[model samples]
Target: MIKRIAYLTSPGPTDRRGVAPGIVTPGFQMEFVQIGTPTLVNDPADLMITDLAYVEAAMRAQRQGFDGIVIGAVADYGLCTIRASVDIPVFGCGQAGLLTAAGIGDKFGIVTIWPETTAFTYDRILRDNPVGRQCVSVRYVSTVAEQAEIADEDGFYQQMQAGREGMMLRILAEIEAAVAEGAQSIVLGCNCMSPVASILAARSSVPVIDPTAAGYRSLESMLLLGLTHAKDPRLPAVSERGPAFAEAVAAVVGTLDEPEECPVCVLDEYGNASCEAPSHEAAPTSADGTAQ
Candidate 1:
């Protein structure tokens, strides 16, 4: 039987969602979930909001009968929380790439786009550390301005084609720098860079891990083995915390304690609580400072 996989993208629908259809493997029916709005994950605070949303999506995915979950982003947003919340295996592209690379070679490095994304990719590598050793190096191949030109779905694909030889050369140069530092394998750190993995691998002597493909294969293997995350340390037993308490925790973590009826609630520009109503409002203030 074909496995049903929830492949969650870190960016909002407009950015990279269109490319998800091309990334799935043969034996899996993939359902893609976007994390949040494009502006929602621009910074660390926003990343936390996106992560919270991801956990909610994961719970829904489990109830909806997905056999496994895959996070397409390199940072692996909400990866652990979702794994703990559900019995199904959850794969993060960052971890997937690192583990796959480790099995193929001694040391690995990641090549990503833009400085912000470079930091995101490197931090995940540091956190996952699947190889048991630090990566040889982490490098960025594009500047913020350059990435801006190709941030859209069509532009991304257009830039990955042979017409953009200059961009490909820059990426190869960064990978070469990692090789100079003794990296024996390469992990394509951005999902948008998946299109070039084969090209990069063919040009080099070491294995090149395509982050999304690694994630899909890893999740597929786990499902075939009937293996989920470990129950002891990786996912401890759940406490008796009920729905009310869970909502409270979510409110605190997501900074979403504002009154739902308030119009401003729709505007969470910085992923924080929406603006409070005027003190003179007819609605009484709830104990939580929200209008009731």
Candidate 2:
């Protein structure tokens, strides 16, 4: 069963809601870890960078003997790759909240932080799932610029509390609007909104699900049941040394303009990356040795 759960917040390490003081439970515990990379994620390019950070963070948690990893975002940024890479169960707030909403309500709506992330909610959480049909609308509390400013600031937690009362009322309005639009339930689309989750849930008549909490509980329950995502048929792994592998190693750990080769990325008996001597590049030698 899960004794420790790591909640990974994306693209940065500024959030302190669940970290500084931390949260406690009877049977297990949750530790919040910042991705500690590109400070914020506003678009697909940002997500590309943050995705790698999140996967690495999850792996680190697994290495530390954590039983489960809960990605603290409604986007579920690296959900697929993380699950494929780790042995423990991986939960994303987006999937967790959406699934929960589907189970309890005939129809639901999503109130996320802002516009750019709203796109992610539609693309990742709603677009493909049958539950998408039940998600009537995905609304936002503010503009992308507003969220970006807060995310970029050093005092993120303080900024989030700047107009706490106003933010709550705005979120409450969104929930009421969703209910008017035939929503039987609502899911807060961003996991970072945990600070105000209780206020939103209390003021709103229909259920206002806190995605972070949903994901946390989901992982905890899965652990108790001895369950996790299917990893059979094994996920993709790099078997050859190439530009692709070299680029990752460079970006993450070094400054290689273009390494000729990278250590062969092979999965050891435990599904861990075990490298051997290099020289696996696919560049072909010409018939004339120097020319084609």
TM-score of each: 0.72, 0.73
Per-residue lDDT over 186-250 for candidate 2, one digit per residue giving the tens place of the 0 to 100 score: 98866556667777788888988877678788887898899988775664531222334335634
RMSD of 1: 9.8
- How much is 261 displaced in model 1, in angstroms? 28
Clashing pairs in 1: none
Rate residue 16 of model 2 by lDDT: 29
Question: In terms of lDDT, which candidate is strongest?
Answer: 2
Worst 10 residues of 1 by lDDT: 283-292
Best by TM-score: 2
lDDT of 2 at 134: 88
How would you encode candidate 1's per-residue C-alpha lDDT over 71-114 as one tens digit per residue? 76667776777767777788877788888788887788877654
Model 1 scores a TM of 0.72
Show model 2 residue runs off by greater than 4 Å: 11-16, 19-24, 116-118, 144-163, 234-292
